[model samples]
Target: MNIKSIILGVLFLFMSGQIALAQSTGTEREITELSKKKWEWMADKNADSLAELFHDKAKFVHMGGTWGKDREVDIIRSGGIHYKKAEIHEVMVEVMGETAILWNRITLLAVVGGNEVSNPFMVTEVYVKQNDTWKLGDLTFSKLLTRD
Candidate 1:
């Protein structure tokens, strides 16, 4: 190819890559904000809002055990495991088509069985888009040895 043609091709590729990057960045921001909101809702024990966000078949994996959406909502509503606060240190998000996976490194203050405690955790959240709305499909918390 001629020098001119090569430069034109390179420019086109650059523009295409930029467009893709912009789209992904937008998605990342949206998912990150939604995750932040979810944490707030959990701390506030807003089961109604959480119920709306969680998918019908959503699963929750805690350090104690795994459960489905309804049970999870009940736990929140009843203050069975009160989420007092989540101090997020870092978040990473990835989008694949209509699905997004978010990872959060956090120190969580919670009341479990009437005992207040704090722990460092790496939390994973999975979201899927259906009918133009994002629903949480999974949430899992893995305890960390150190806060980092």
Candidate 2:
């Protein structure tokens, strides 16, 4: 009711909002780390870890085709599409409520159909928080014009 009390209340609200923003940023960092782990798992062909990270309804899109979680897992498990290495140029992540979007620019070395290929791609990954844990909801890879 008083002027001093009003100003104090506003300051309190502002500080609380800042705290929430900091927490969200922390979550974004966690998702980023999880994403890096996913790339490692893919390179290692760790289907079990991938299965746990990917949501049951997750979808994957590639230059060749698009598929659901099961097919993607199978592809990685069977060496149909082996991710040999990823040279990450940059990664940016945004958190929106329970969903997070990650954008990554990288040079990917992969073995597909018995042929080894290296290409630059911009990958977008969508993650949704499920039971307080982030799970991959969708992933798409777009080929980049520049090889570097």
Candidate 3:
């Protein structure tokens, strides 16, 4: 290829990469905001909104056990496990194409089995973009020793 053509090709590739990076940044921000909203919904026990946000095949892992979407919604709706509040200390997100992974550190106040408890945890949330909307695919909570 001539020098001019080579230079143009390189410029085009560079611009494409820039655009992709920008899109990924935007996706990350969107996922972060969604995660915040999800916490609010969980605390409020808004099963309807949570149902819409969670994928059909979504799974949840807690200190006790792992379960599917329906069981999780049932627990929230029935007040078997209530997420009273979450004090988010930090959050970080990574977007990979259509999937995003979010890491959150927080102190959580929850009521389980008629008793209220507080604990610190590292929460991992995985979301997948399907049909232009992000849906929760997996969530796992790792209990932390210190409640700093």
Counting clashing residue pairs in each candidate, in order, gives 0, 0, 0
Q: What are the lDDT figures for the candidates, one per model?
A: 0.97, 0.96, 0.95
Residues 22-64, candidate 1, lDDT per residue (tens digit)? 9999999999999999999999999999999999999999999
Highest TM-score model number: 2
The TM-scores, one per candidate, come to 0.93, 0.96, 0.92
Better of 1 and 3 by TM-score: 1
Q: Per-prediction RMSD in angstroms?
A: 1.4, 1.0, 1.4
What C-alpha lDDT, on a 0 to 100 scale, does residue 57 get in candidate 1? 98
lDDT of 3 by residue, 1-148 (tens): 8999999999999999999999888888899899999999999999999999999999999999999999999999999999999899999999888889999999999999999999999999999989999999999999998987
At residue 144, candidate 1 shows an lDDT of 98
**Off by more than 4 A, model 1:** 1-6
Cα displacement (angstroms), candidate 3, residue 86, comes to: 1.4
The positional error of residue 75 in candidate 1, measured at the CA in angstroms, is: 0.5
Which runs of model 2 end up more than 4 angstroms from their true locations? none
For model 2, the local distance difference test gives 0.96
lDDT of 3: 0.95
